[model samples]
Target: MAAERPVPTHEVTNQVPPVVGRDISTSPALLEGLRREGGGWAEDEVRALALLGNSETWQQAGRLANDHPPVLHTHDRYGNRVDEVEYLPQYHDLMRKAVAHGLHGAPWVDPRPGAHVARAAKVVAWGVADAGHLCPISMTYAVVPALRATPELALQYEPLLTNGVYEPALRAPQDKGGLIAGMSMTEKQGGSDVRANTTVAVPAGDGSHRLTGHKWFTSAPMSDLFLTLAQTDAGLSCFLVPRVLPDGTRNAFFLQRLKDKLGNKSNASGEVEYDGATGWLVGEQGRGVATIIEMVNMTRLDCSLMAAGGMRLNVAHALHHATHRSAFGRRLVDQPAMTNVLADLAVDSEAASAVVMRLAGAVDRAMRGDEAERAFRRVALSVTKYQLCKRLAPHTVEALECLGGNGYVEDSGMPRLYREAPLISIWEGSGNVAALDTLRALGREPAAVEAFLAELELAGGADGRYDDALAVLHKELVDLGDPEDLQFRARRVVERMALLLQGSLLIRHGDHAVADAFVASRLAGDRGRDYGTLPSGIDTRAVLARAAVPE
Candidate 1:
């Protein structure tokens, strides 16, 4: 080292600076969407969250939490079973921030015009901090609607789930300052088909039921309560299972083992055994799917929001790298090919941001008794969940490639983001499951299809390419007569529907550059399959300007 230092050959150069300090909430696409979707009142609150969410300290917390995954302690030294999950303090910090910002169920409590919209913006804003801890946060937000099926249970636990205080202990629900919730439904035997679940719940003389079954996949195993499913005398039913009973004794919920997963390492998903665990019924005894569908829909919406948010982060990292790093005696951002790729990525990311906030708006209005929005959500959420979640992985891959070898390294942060991108597609439902669900919604409720079409019509006549695409889609729908045929083409139909919806929203609300490029490239088929293939006419500079990294 002394000899090398004597030669004076060491130099550090061309390394891109990490995106830090600046507020990530300043995303033009996300902010425009926040205001457009009825969350304008919470812009200041959203910025306040960004003050910490995007800070250098919290960014380090994200890395540390992921680096040190959660540990499960199945038994104590005294030979007593103590089913507990131990996450790093950094993980809890993220959870605390998320809860304090009303990202969980707090929107349900707030009686404001855009309560859900505000919560959604926080989700997108804070999401850049970390994706793993949000598993429990999302479930906590989702459980409220399903729990409301039983007003007494909702009255008891809703306040705690939405509580801003972050309590990380296992105590009686009433005694805890706040609560997190999870769901246990899928088993090895049945993934999406909860009807095939082998779990059985036997009623005790008391109102609660004793659930005895093995859950193949239980998310956030340490959460205080879970909405699970088991077979009863009547049929499949939903039950609220708590880790600690009302009397303050541990229930029979056991963590068999933590799942060795591909990503979301900071979140503890496990193979849980509900061995005679005490649980209370959630809704009508025989209508388990119907009761839990509300929770499922809420989680579905969060999945899409996370997908959208995740895309924004990937673009941010890639664009930041491009803006700073140099190549072949020039900055990467100035290269025409790199510029095309970055601009294409921004266009797709902006489309996602626009649609997710619109869907969040629909969720807010639907919860507030807007029948039209409810119908639209019944169809739109599923389609969006299918399209956006599926798009994120490939989008992330392209973004990762924009940084070349640097992105491949762990320090670049793109690898973690890339790992997290595919989870949402699998979480609420897999791609096929989501696509089929959209088809089911279209089939069951005529109102759903009508609402979906009415929404697409909002951007009518904005662009000729869009109009032509819409005409082709309409003709295809008219010709789509056979159920078997529709099912066969389900994903394709849904993708087209999603693109058209995105195109329409961009035409009406998104930046002009984004709308024109999206319509031209996506609908008109004037581009290649890979990114950076925009036609010569597209304004790459205008689109990238909206996604530019702040000074």
Candidate 2:
């Protein structure tokens, strides 16, 4: 009646069955091509298509991000500022392009527990691993692109982005580049212990201040900028101190010495001396903890990614060696024990990656304007950052052991994990700091905690598998919201909270291969429970109180 609208020949053939099943496996020739292409292009295509599929949403977000300027500063590898040269328009353009291209989508659209943030973090970590740098540059990419958002101090810091002394810094030579480029952050006392900071930011009447103190470990000694934290009446406040003058010249800060240490050798750690080093206040007084956290959160997530990447590298090395090495008249891979070891390593790396990704996703979501989901995402991020780093290090070490004597050798790259793994657990916030923070966050925001639990329940966690995990965790947690034996129940209660978050994130973002691996990882907890004994009761309150009470 409608002019036989769909009676076309192709349409008529649609009902016919194929001679055999579709068999989508690649042919040998195509497989070779894919292998030759190194899979990156394919992954990019897949990643791109995923983003393109939601173009309308991301496009809108992009517009929003473009309206705001970035926090531009010239920094060395150690987070110190170099100078305030005019901002480079090219970088602004690139950042805008990254936003337009949907670099931000992974942060918000997927709505993972913490996976989004972790994704941005992973990018930064990869840069660190490859270039031995850690600026959390990827975070700006993720934050602006994904959330279409800007930091609160965007106005104050934006001018430095387009016009700052660091403009030439991005173009500086590698070896002779600025001092802070590949340095690490450290204090004579401790790494993330701001309260323990010995550096003093003494104000000079002209709205500038002199920074005096000794920094034990600093990354990117060649960097032009240092995001140094100091004690203020309000509390710990950070400043955007430059290594050079406003006229693009070197300042008084001196690199006192360099630390010859473990695997991050590609990264040069230095002891720095700042004498009357002038710096600009980054934000309001006493807001150092809050403002610098913008960078710290970014750094912590970066550490998680670095750990994951190291684990991935370790697993890859183990697999390659196992498949190639021979032992006792058989290929090492042929041995059941060796096979199990490799399998376990793969599983651990995969699971840890999944947890990190979920945390990253939550960060992405929060950036995208789901304020209600933000608090939960923050809690989830802290937990994942702590758990993944703690859990994956041992896994990596064990995997390296599968390589036997070879793993210990620096040339093998396995030793790097052992050396650098501590960076994750110690920096940003230590494992203990993270664990206690998770508990404290729950206590401070009970509704968010309940919401987080409800989220787990919604994500296929109502069944025995989820409940069993939670039940095991419950025995260790303390319900601060309710006074009933909360003190005795501290660890388990907090653990359950962690499990709930883990399970929820894994279930929600299980689409990716990484996420799928998490479903399998829950078995580890079960095994640990069966074979391992629950430790003696822990008083989280006391532990937290001790940490809170300063010496």
Deviating ranges (above 4 Å) for candidate 2? 1-42, 45-131, 135-186, 328-330, 461-463, 472-478, 481-500, 507-551
Look at candidate 2 and tell me the lDDT of residue 528. 39
Estimate the TM-score of every prediction: 0.98, 0.65
Q: Tens-digit lDDT track for model 1 on 432-489?
A: 9999998887778889998999989989887889999998888876666799988899
Q: Each prediction's Cα RMSD? A: 1.5, 16.7
Which regions of candidate 1 are displaced past 4 Å? 1-5
Scored by lDDT, model 1 comes in at 0.91
Q: Which candidate comes out best when scored by lDDT?
A: 1
Let me know the TM-score candidate 2 reaches against the reference structure: 0.65
How does each model score on lDDT? 0.91, 0.49
